[model samples]
Target: MPVANRIPILCLGLLLATTSCERPAPPTTAEASDSYNLAAYIEQQQERLQAEKPMVLKSVTTEEKPTETIQTAEIDWEDELSVFAETDLNRPALQEYYTREERVLPDGNIVLEYNRVEDAEPLVHYLRLEMTPDRVLRQLNALIQDQNILFYSRRNIQLTADPSSGNISGYRVQGVQKLVLSDSLHYQIDANL
Candidate 1:
C-alpha cells in the first residue's frame, strides 16, 4: 500500500486501541474461592478477638449486682446533729470554730458536745446535749458566756429539740447584746427560737 494509505490505517488502529483498551479476564472460580476464604478467616479472627477481650465494668456489674442502693447510717444519731440541726457540715466554712463530739454514757444514752463560735460576736458557745441513740431528745445545757470586750446582759435560755427532726421545737433565749460600733444600746430580747 502507499504511505498515505498506511498513515490513515495507523491512525484508525490508534483510535481503536485508545477507545477500547481492555485487560485479560480474571479466573472466576479461583479468585472467588480465594476471596471467600479470606473473608471467612477475617470473620473467625474477629470472633476470637472478641472472645479474648475482657468484659466492660458496666456490663459485668449489671450482670452480677443490682443497679444501686443507699446504705444505712453508721454513726450515732447524736453525732448527726449538724445534719439534723440544719447546721453546716463543712467545718472550714465556719472558720474552723465549730466542733462536735459524741460519747456513750453508762446509762446507754448518747452525749453530744458542741462548741460553736458566735458569728455575730467574738463570744464562744458551749453546748452539751443528752439524748438516746434512736433520736430521743432528753436535755440540753447551753452556755452563751459573755466576753469582756462587749457589754452583754444575758438572763436565761430554755431550748428543746425535737426527737425526730433533731431541731429546736420550743426555744426561749433572753439576752441583750450591744455591738462595739454604735452608741445605741439594745434592751431585753426575749423571743421563741
Candidate 2:
C-alpha cells in the first residue's frame, strides 16, 4: 500500500482503540434509591441479627458476710482528773535540790513529785499549783506549735486536754503528744483526763 494510505489506516486504528476504552457511567440518584430501601434494608438486617443466638450473661451473687464491728465506750472525766491529781502528788521528787521526778504516761499524762526541804513550804506550795485540762493542753500546745521547736526539743511532746472530756468538765484533760523526727520517726506520748 502507498505510505499515505497506510498513515490514514494507522490513524483510524488509534481512534477506534481510544474510543473503545470508555468508563461505565455512574448510577443516577433515582437508580441508587431504587437499589437500596433504607427502612426495609435496616429491618432485614435487624431480622438477620435477631435470628442469631444471643449471648448469655450470668449475674453472680456474693455469699461472704462482714465479721466484726467496732464500738467505743464513753470516758469519765471527773474520775480521770482525780486519778491524775493523786498520781502527780504521790510521785517522788528527783534527788537534786528543788528538782522533781516527772513521769509521763504513753498517753501524755504527766506526774511529778518533789522533795521538801525542812521549813521550805515553798516547794510544796509550788507543787500544789492547780492544773486544768485546758491549761495543760494550752501549755503543751505552746511548746509544740512550731515544727522547728518540736524537732530540736526533747520535751516538745506533751499531753493536751481531751476535747471530749474537757467539754463535760472544763478542767478535764486528755490528748496525745507526738514528737516527729527529721527521719519521719515519731515519739508518741498520750494522756487522758
Candidate 3:
C-alpha cells in the first residue's frame, strides 16, 4: 500500500479503459445503394414529367369563297302609281270625304273624279285651305294634344325656327311617344312637319 505504487496502478487502469472502447463501423454499400435508388426514382419522375409536357399550339386557317351578287329588275311606273293611289284612296279620312272612284297613273300619281256633292265639297275645301308653316305647326300641335302623345326627347320641344323670320319653316323631329294601352310598347314618331 505505498502511495507511489497505487498511483501506477490507477494510470494503468485508465489506459486500458480508453484503449478498449471501439468506434462504430461505417455504413455498407447496400445502404448507399438504397439512397442511390431513391435519387434514381426522383430523376425518373422528372424525366417522365418533361416527356409528357404539352407542345406549342397553333391557330387554324379557313378557306375563303367569293360572294355572289343578285340583281333585280325595276318595277313599272304605272304599277307604282296605282299602288300609291290605292293606298291614298283607302285612307280613313279620304274614304269618308270622297264618294268617288279614284284612279292611279303609272307615275305613282292619283287622279280623283268625285261622283257626289260631299266629295266635291271636301276636294274644294282641301284645295282652298292654306298650308302655311304656322298653320301646319298649329295643326301638328293639335294632333299631338288630341292623341295624347308624349315626346321622349330630353328637350320639351324638338324644333328649329328660321332666325330672320322667327318662323318654323322646315325642321325635323324624332322622339318616342307613349301609346295608350300597354306600358311595354312605345310609338316612335319621326317626321318633318
Candidate 4:
C-alpha cells in the first residue's frame, strides 16, 4: 500500500476505538425519575378546586307590590258628616242645619247650645257647651270626656265653643258626642233638641 493511504486508514481506526472505550455516567437522584405523573396530578387538582368552591343556584325570581293613594278633593262633605259636625258651629254650613242659643248662668259661666233640625247619622242632635275659662282643663275635662249621669241623665249636652262668636267648637271632639250611656236617653234628649 502507498504511505499516504496507510496513514488515513490508521487515523480512522484510532477514532472508532477511543469512542467505543468510554462509558456513560450514572444518573443522579434528581434525574433518576424523569417521567412525570402529569395527568393524575391535574385530575387531583381539579377535584380539590371543586370541593373548595361555593355552591351556586341555577335560577332565581323576584316580585314587587303595587300601592294606591286617594286625593283629598275627591272626598264628599255629606259623607264626612260625623267629622264636619265635630268642628266649630259658627261655620254657616253647619249652623244652617241647626238652631243655636247662648246663655250666661248666675255663676259667671257661659253656656252655648245647638240643636239639629235635620237628621244626620253618627252626629249629635243636641250640643250644650259650658265655658269656665278660669278653670283648669283637668277639672273641665271629665264633663266633656265622660257622660255625666246627672247631666246626661235627662237631656243634656256639654259643649265647647268659640268665646267671641258663641259658636260651638271642639273639646277633644267638636259639638255633642254620639256615644251616650243609653240610646233611649239620647232619644229623650233628641226630643228636646
Candidate 5:
C-alpha cells in the first residue's frame, strides 16, 4: 500500500483501539461491606433539603465571642451537613480498618457502632447510629480526631432525625483545635432544620 494509504489505516486502527478500551468503574458506597452506606444517606439528605429550602435556625459559639443565632431560608445544606458526610466510613480503603457491631435495645431500637481496630488510628475514631426496628434512622454520632506536630483537632458531630420521616431535625458540631504558637480554640455549632 502507498504511504498515504497506510497512514490512514494506522490512524483508524489507533482510534478503534482507544475507543474500545474499558475504563474501570468507580467504587460504590455499598462495596465496602454489609455496612450502612453513610455517604449515600447524606447525599439523599442533601438533595431533599436543597429541594425543600427549609428555614434553618443556627447558633454558633466560639471562644472569641458569645453565641450568635441566625434564622433564614438561605441554607447551605451541603455545608451544613458536611460533617456528617465526611464521617462516612464505607470507602473501599476503610473496609478492613474497623469493625461494626449491631444490637437491639429493649425499646426495640437498633443500634450500630463502628470502632477502629486495635492498632489503627483512623480519622473517625468512633461512629454510632440509632435506628428504628424497621431501619429508620433516628440519630448519628461520630468522633473525628487528627493530630500532628503542627496542629491537633478533634470534632464531635451529631445528627438527629425524625424516625418516621428520616428528615434531619437538628445537628451539632463541637470541636477544639490547637495549632503551634496559638492558643487552643473551641467552637460549637447547633442548628435546626
Candidate 6:
C-alpha cells in the first residue's frame, strides 16, 4: 500500500485499538468489601473538619527530658489526621493481608479489630475501631511502625470521636524513634479538635 493510503488505515486502526478496551471502574466511596471503608471514612472526616475549621488545643511533648508545648489555633484537619489516614487498610492490595474480627460489648458498643496475618509486616501492625451500637464511630486506634538498618520508629495513634455527633473530639500520637547512631527520641502529641 502507498504511504498516503496507509495513513488513513493506520489512523483507523489506532482509533479502533484505543476504543476497544474499557477503563476499569474506579472504586466507589462506599466500596463494598470485607474490610471497613477506612480510606473513605477518613476522607469524610477530613472533609467535614476542613469545612468546619474548628479551633484545636494541641499539646506536644518530646525528648527524654520532656519539654511540653501547647497551642490553640485552627489546623488543617487533612494534614493533622493524615497519620490516621495512613493506617487505612481498605486498599485492594491489603484486602487479603489483614484479618478482621468483630465483637459486641455488653455495654452495647461494637468493636472491630484488624490484625495482620502471620508473617505479614504491614506498616500499620494493628487497628481497632470502637463504635456505638447505632454504628457511630467512637474511637480508632492503630499501631504504626517502620524500621530499617538506619532508623526505627513506632507510634501508637488514637482518635476519639463523639458518638452522637460523630465529630472528632481529640487525638493522641505517642511514639519513639531511634537512629542508627543517635539516641532514641520520645514524643507525644495530644490534640483536642
In order of lDDT, best first, we have 5, 6, 1, 4, 2, 3
Mind giving the per-residue lDDT tens digits that candidate 1 earns over 1-193? Answer: 8998899899999999987766434335442222112123224433543444322111111223444322322323232222123222222333356566778899887776667745644233665667767636655555564656655543234445556654443433444455566453333222222
Error of 3 at 146 (Å): 14
**TM-score pick, better of 3 and 4:** 4
Give the per-residue Cα lDDT of candidate 3 at 99: 42
Q: Give all candidates' CA lDDT scores.
A: 0.44, 0.33, 0.30, 0.37, 0.87, 0.84
The superposed Cα distance between candidate 5 and the true structure at residue 70, in angstroms, equals: 0.5
Q: Please report the candidate that would top TM-score against the real structure.
A: 5
lDDT of 2 by residue, 48-152 (tens): 334442232212221243322222233232332332332232212212224444555565544443444454433222232223322232222112121344643
TM-score of 1: 0.33
- Per lDDT, the best of the predicted structures is 5
Model 3 ranges off by over 4 Å: 1-156, 177-183, 188-193
Residue 151, model 1, lDDT? 59
Worst 10 residues of 1 by lDDT: 54-63
> What lDDT is obtained when candidate 3 is compared to the true structure?
0.30
Please give the range of 10 consecutive residues that has the lowest summed lDDT in model 4.
184-193
Per-candidate TM-scores read: 0.33, 0.18, 0.16, 0.27, 0.81, 0.79
Worst 10 residues of 2 by lDDT: 137-146
Clashing pairs in 5: none
Model 5 misplacement above 4 A = 1-33
Better of 3 and 5 by TM-score: 5
Say what the RMSD of model 6 is: 5.4
How do the residues 1-193 of candidate 3 rate in per-residue lDDT, one tens digit apiece? 9998999899999989887775434335442222212123224423543454322122212124332222222323233122112222222333345444334446433333333235233322221111222222111111111132542211111223333333332222222344455442222222221
lDDT of predicted model 6: 0.84
* lDDT (Cα, tens digit) per residue for candidate 4, span 1-193: 9999999899999999998876544333342232122223224433543444322211111123222222222222232222323333443234456665656679776555666675542134555545554321111111122344433322222323345543223223222333354343222111000
- Which digits, one per residue and each the tens of the lDDT, describe model 5 over residues 1-193? 7898899899999999998785434455443455666788899999999999999899999997989999988987888788898788766667688888889999999898989999998889999999988878899999999999999999999999999998899999999999999999999999998
Report how far off residue 148 is in candidate 2 (Å).
Answer: 16
